[model samples]
Target: MESRSRRRSRSRNRERPYEITISTADMSSKMQTFIMEQVIECLNNRSHPKKMCRYIRERCNARYGPSWDCFVAREYYGSFAYVPRHLLGFELNGLNFLIFKGA
Candidate 1:
């Protein structure tokens, strides 16, 4: 089988546009763990989702390019289930508070 880099190069030279699909399952265990760690740190800091997204983009761009969306989405959804219900609402500082408790 051809290596991924070789396949990419071949596709680039072809006239047809090639679509590459990479799922979380395709990532290495180390990469998945690293991404999860970053997500946990951001959530623990109570950073807004938008800010978290930006941070993810900046941190992951070099390695994952524009494909970091899946990581962010997975983390956000996981957070919803893990975060306390009281902290799961409202938008503040342009950050959607996934957990907000009403007084």
Candidate 2:
């Protein structure tokens, strides 16, 4: 059974709007908007960063290709090597979203 506080917490999350800002994107603008939607929806359902990353990767892979990789974190750095026109970095609800396909 779920506690009342837990349920309320989830309800609050679902009610909040997620704002997305593109930090750096090598991909298309259409892809950026699509990813923003995916990220927001995933965030509504999942509370963990790893789960969010996997969710975004799976979505991208289904629509684009299987090489899709996603990193969801509050802070990220240290060299990202990805294919041309297949990398996007953004901020969604305060977390850094980095999606790319390996070269």
Candidate 3:
């Protein structure tokens, strides 16, 4: 019985991927607006996405050591013009995009 409860608690605390939430009460207030603008500017003018991915991988390494599968792929094969659907955790096939969570 104790082991079963422990297993239930562990399952309850599972990590969620890509969880982004903003808690500010006023999304349109001046300060909030300014911050949002800054974020957009950074996203728009940031360095080449490929280079940025490498930079991100390096930083993540410093904090979490290294991961073999962490990577970035483009929307098209051997191209970097846009982020790939696969990178967003989706599978693509004839006019269909499937997204699922994996354990």
TM-score of each: 0.40, 0.78, 0.29
The residue-by-residue lDDT of candidate 1 on 1-103, one tens digit each, is: 1113211111223354322222223334455345444545565567766777677556655554443332233224443222121121222223322221122
If the candidates were sorted by their TM-score against the true structure, best first, what order would they fall in? 2, 1, 3
TM-score of 2: 0.78
Give lDDT for model 2: 0.73
**Pairs with backbone N, CA or C atoms under 3 Å apart (clashes), candidate 3:** none
Model 1 scores what on Cα lDDT? Answer: 0.37
Report clashes for each candidate as comma-separated counts.
6, 0, 0
Better lDDT candidate (1, 2): 2
- Identify the runs in model 3 with alpha carbons over 4 angstroms from their true place: 1-45, 73-103
lDDT by residue for model 3 (1-103), tens: 0011110111122332212123212112343233223223323455454553455445434543444122333342332222221122211111111111111
lDDT of 1 at 24: 20
lDDT of 3 at 96: 14
**What pairs collide in candidate 2?**
none
**Model 3 TM-score (2 dp):** 0.29
- Per-residue alpha-carbon lDDT of model 2 for 1-103, expressed as tens digits? 1111111112244667554566677877687667777777777776698888888889999998889988888897868678888887877667887888888
Candidate 3 lDDT score at position 62 = 55
For model 3 the local lDDT of residue 88 reads 22
Cα lDDT, model 3, residue 43: 34
Please name the candidate that would achieve the greatest lDDT relative to the true structure.
Answer: 2
